[model samples]
Target: MANMQWTLLLLIWMGQCCVIDCQLYEFHYINKEKTWTEAQQYCREKHTDLVTVTNMKDIKRLINISPGNWRGAWIGLYGQTDGTRKWHWSLPGVEFNESEKNWNTGEPNDKTGWQNCGIIWKNLKWGDLSCHDHQYFLCYDDKYILINKNKTWEDALIYCRDHHHDLVTITNMDQQRAVQQEAQFASTDYVWMGLSYACTLDLWFWVSDEVVRYKNWALDGPMDDCDMSGAMETKGNHQWCKKDDTEKFNFICST
Candidate 1:
């Protein structure tokens, strides 16, 4: 295993629960215009981070809130410093899929060579513009917050309860992907999740009081034992594994 950073301060990416029937984050339309950076600051201060739209449903919701000749609105998507023209969601752990793009015809031309920021056009497709340009933006309250600080599973639980809601609960695949995005940034090989074993009951259950119906166990079955909780790997496939509760690692929280 990689070495751990026990005392490092970590950033919490306010994430949204992207369940098909439920969402942990709520979106808001800022009618007032601001530069991309300014808008980002506003959102971080008042709400969660800027919105991280993972699928078509998010776009539809954005459109529903910002109707009428929408003009253009800033989104969380941005160009990386590498100039790969690689677009990344503002929230860490959220993914940007090339296949699911909603770009306008002949869009992202970057014709000016410096149109690095992203915006949603009136037609609901995406376009590129200068980051300095002023425009309205969208923000989500809270979803899946990744806490980078390393802590034991028990300590992590207390921290989450004091700061946000509870540790994350992955009851479905969508929630799995949602939490997996944040897991990718963990300083440790794996990040603590909310599931734990109950030796008396002889079963694993989510701390959020949900059943372990949506299983993503790394092995055929998780080890049923005492002093074990669940953690998700940071790399490939991001499957869940039973981890010792006394072990320290970063964690994700559901809000």
Candidate 2:
């Protein structure tokens, strides 16, 4: 009886260690010289896409890798002068949903035959603009911080509690939008969200103890994983994806 009890305890302990979740991304810098197209191909074959700089955080990261001299490098940004108007978000996961767009009247005319990027006007309407045009851009600052280190969900939660507040809690669309904006700076396709399922209760809840009343689950909905936790896609629609807690990933913590 004593031996059986000890074995059961050991199993439980192991299980606990296996269910850690995380959210965040990693980056690598290549010093090789190449044009934008070449660099894109190289990054795809060797690493991920050529560093997609979406926010100041990404810019700072790039600056840190500077050669300390007046040397230039190629990034993933380019202009399509072929009169092809393909709308894409400067940020990754927040894809341009045609069904959810608000374009200005007769806008996106590609008036100068060089509008490839997009912007939201003062009226909260979107417009296709010149990719080369230098203009003021909107930046969102959520109270959450992205941790670049890889850790399990449990480990990430503890780190957030010890360092910042706790893992982030998204209660509404506004909060979700804030998180999605923040995620654009992530190095990973998905970042951890403070959501989890309790097998004992057979219910989902946020780590911040907020009721799971609001959700932005992925099109497929949350996957079944009693030992899994929630993460947000950093590339498309910023929907939540269920992943095993044991999977190591970069994470976000609330401030």
Candidate 3:
């Protein structure tokens, strides 16, 4: 590694002994210094990988983990070496969007030399820099939490965003069981989840961008409508229920 500078960036592995589904992605800040490539390898071996910036919300989280003012770190995005200058997220399955550019004014410029790697700037914007330039970088981890107070789906979402992360997403039985343990203490019959129905698309989706691979719907099946959102029973099988978005209930948040 060359020109490595110090900043906190590292991924601490999660609880393996627990029965709960703690697959919620988390950003870790390690103080260790390394080159961009070294940082990427370290993250992949220690946790998931370098951070992926999906939206402004992710940017805000990245900024929160930042060590100090004017300091920056490597993100998952990088430029093509073929001179196409095409940008791509390092995490597979995440597609780069033309509309998602948060480049600071007149950036990705070659004036700084053959800039190829993407680093998040202190201004909360992305810019191109040398991959060989060592710096502290962010790696991601995962976890979840339960909020016992009752509130509407929208309100619950706001609370989770304000206090923790977004609403929890359960894509498998491991996660379902883990979250269900928290649900048992809910004040309401059902707990607000991140699931929602898109009427135009006519499908249920997780608000956290997780694909609905696994399901635990009630016997009657999911109710699909614009006003419908997902919840989990606090009792019985803890199957998912389709409820109106206006309904109030306890909720889960990822940490």
Candidate 4:
């Protein structure tokens, strides 16, 4: 019995150590000017991707990095011309699925032939639009918060990091259910989750770097793709579906 008690204490200590060692994401600013594509390449080769600014904190950090009334620099955001969009979280590691989608009528119609990004309407319906179009976006933090504003997956990631934490990461049924309850009060048809896809890795992971062990995919299964993120239906079994990361939606965050 004494030995078992010691083992339990050791395990608790190890868990605490892990928590202490977990570091929040960092940002690096490159003063050199470059196009979006060039900047992405530079960031990938040097740091991570061209600074995925997730929120006000990141924006401020970026400003502090230079500490000047500078104009602007290229970020990780860019569009694809190959007609194949690669879905990715503003935060890294999260994966996207193609099967889960909630598009509005005639969505992705490419009305102007340049519709390559995604957006969420006030009603929470998704639609494809031009990536060049400018709109307020969302970002994720490492903390938790329930934001009522609409934003794309990448934007949501930045927002959370700036305001509270990253988007909420649900690793268990209890967490999922709690988020589902939060969804009940959402004004939209669904709420954005911290879930996203990494096209390069071809896998899913939470922005918080948690393992993708527990899942709540819908009965129809999830769609796989490079341009989608995970979202929970406000009304159904709370099953997750795929959505274009560019699509805006209210999101939850956690620390």
Candidate 5:
């Protein structure tokens, strides 16, 4: 009887340890330069795949602890031929949570029409950039880390600026899927993001810090009409905004 009791206690302790271990969030790094396919293979071989975000809180916690890394990195979201951007995880039929989406400019735009990979930027905003762009990324599992308070897509963008520097920009596909999952629930329609246009330069700019690198505008979309407060007549000044908050053809907000 004594031996059996001791064995049962030991089993209970071991089970507790396993639960705790699974809850602990750890960071992984991949330094090899390769195509998106190669990178995904590398991550999978290392007991992980490209990073996947779950919520804004997870993003804040992950970036806060990471140091000495590049600005943009690969994630898991990719483009489809149906003219729709879907989260990779959602490809498995998992519902997206609005709280997980932290788009800097509020919408997913595959400018090149061929971009199938995602990336996270310096300001923690998410975007669908070319998979050829090389950078370090983040990975997440069964860990719970509280992120910034929930706010509307517009409010969220402003919050990122007022507090954390800029709206969340994706550097890789992993981060993209994570954000998509979080914001998916609240996303009834497209929303506004941190991306915008520069009338003088006639190019797209990440509203977070005005950094312009990836220019993937649709055919004659952002036509800068000199309307500072109104919509753009063409693709020149067609800034990205939330789809819900568009008051009379304005921007939309998710969650």
Candidate 6:
């Protein structure tokens, strides 16, 4: 009798552990019709809030689950009370982690007078667009294994800066492998990286305020011939160079 009871207890413990380990993360979607306020309310009703991504993997997973037009969904950030344009997550008053705040070139403009709220753009980067714009949004619920979504190089980079830290910087083989796995969905498009020649040093730099730890360039470095004289020149330079924020591309964002 004692042996049988011990066996049953062991089985129960193993089962519980398996159940806990099997919890996977899932991406939820809301149509674009809801205003920011309404979308927030809807998420609350569903027992989840607007999504809060904490890492590159999370960003990718959400993008993969979301469709192209689901751009207008609410995220965790909101305008400050004074309306001076300090954005923050709507969770239980978590401090603004500077390391996680990625901004595009002269972003957070709050172009529209009431652009106090933040939302994910079609490109995956967080932007301070007018709150009234109708676009699909994403929500997340913790489950088992992690999943990531696909993004263009420009959008991915912007998303990383606005939500998480910055475009992923590959330091070593391990980090490279991890980012590659997260970016698997972008097999056709190039995912943006923090590397750029924008600085005086003319070398790559990380946007997260960290030193240049690693680099993986496609042979011969980036070439910049910013001499396109036509209307295209006004847009921005076309460069094989590294770290040009002006160059529009998709990127990953995280908390």
Candidate closest to the true structure, highest lDDT: 1
Better lDDT candidate (1, 3): 1
Q: What is the C-alpha lDDT of each candidate?
A: 0.78, 0.60, 0.76, 0.58, 0.45, 0.48
Off by over 4 Å in 2: 1-141
TM-score of each: 0.79, 0.47, 0.50, 0.45, 0.42, 0.44
Q: What's the CA RMSD of model 6 in angstroms?
A: 19.2
Each prediction's Cα RMSD?
A: 9.0, 16.5, 14.3, 20.0, 19.0, 19.2
Our model 1 lands, by Cα RMSD against the true structure, at: 9.0
Can you rank all candidates by lDDT, best first?
1, 3, 2, 4, 6, 5
Task: Candidate 3: give the clashing pairs.
Answer: 7-31, 8-29, 8-30, 8-31, 9-29, 9-30, 9-31, 10-30, 24-142, 26-141
Measured by TM-score, how close is model 1 to the native structure?
0.79
lDDT of 6 by residue, 152-252 (tens): 44555556656654555444443444344334444224445555443445444455444544444445554543311000011122112343344444443
lDDT tens digits, residues 109-223, model 3? 8566768888887877888888888776877753666787879999999999998878998766657865886787788999999999989999888987767878999999996
Q: Model 1 scores what on Cα lDDT?
A: 0.78
Q: Candidate 2: what lDDT?
A: 0.60
User: What is the model-wide C-alpha lDDT for candidate 5?
Assistant: 0.45
- Which lDDT tens digits does candidate 2 get at residues 1-255? 111100000011111223112112334444443444454555566544543434434345434543333133333433344455454443345554556545679876778776655554444344665555443332222356788878889999999999988888877664676677777677777888789989888888998776887788888887666898999888878889899999887788876
Give the top-scoring candidate (TM-score): 1
- Which is the winner by TM-score between candidate 5 and candidate 6? 6
State in Å the error of residue 130, model 6. 2.5
How does residue 15 of candidate 1 score in lDDT?
Answer: 43
How many angstroms is residue 19 displaced in model 3 relative to the true structure, after the best TM-score fit? 16
Preferred candidate (TM-score higher): 1 or 2: 1
- Quote model 6's TM-score: 0.44
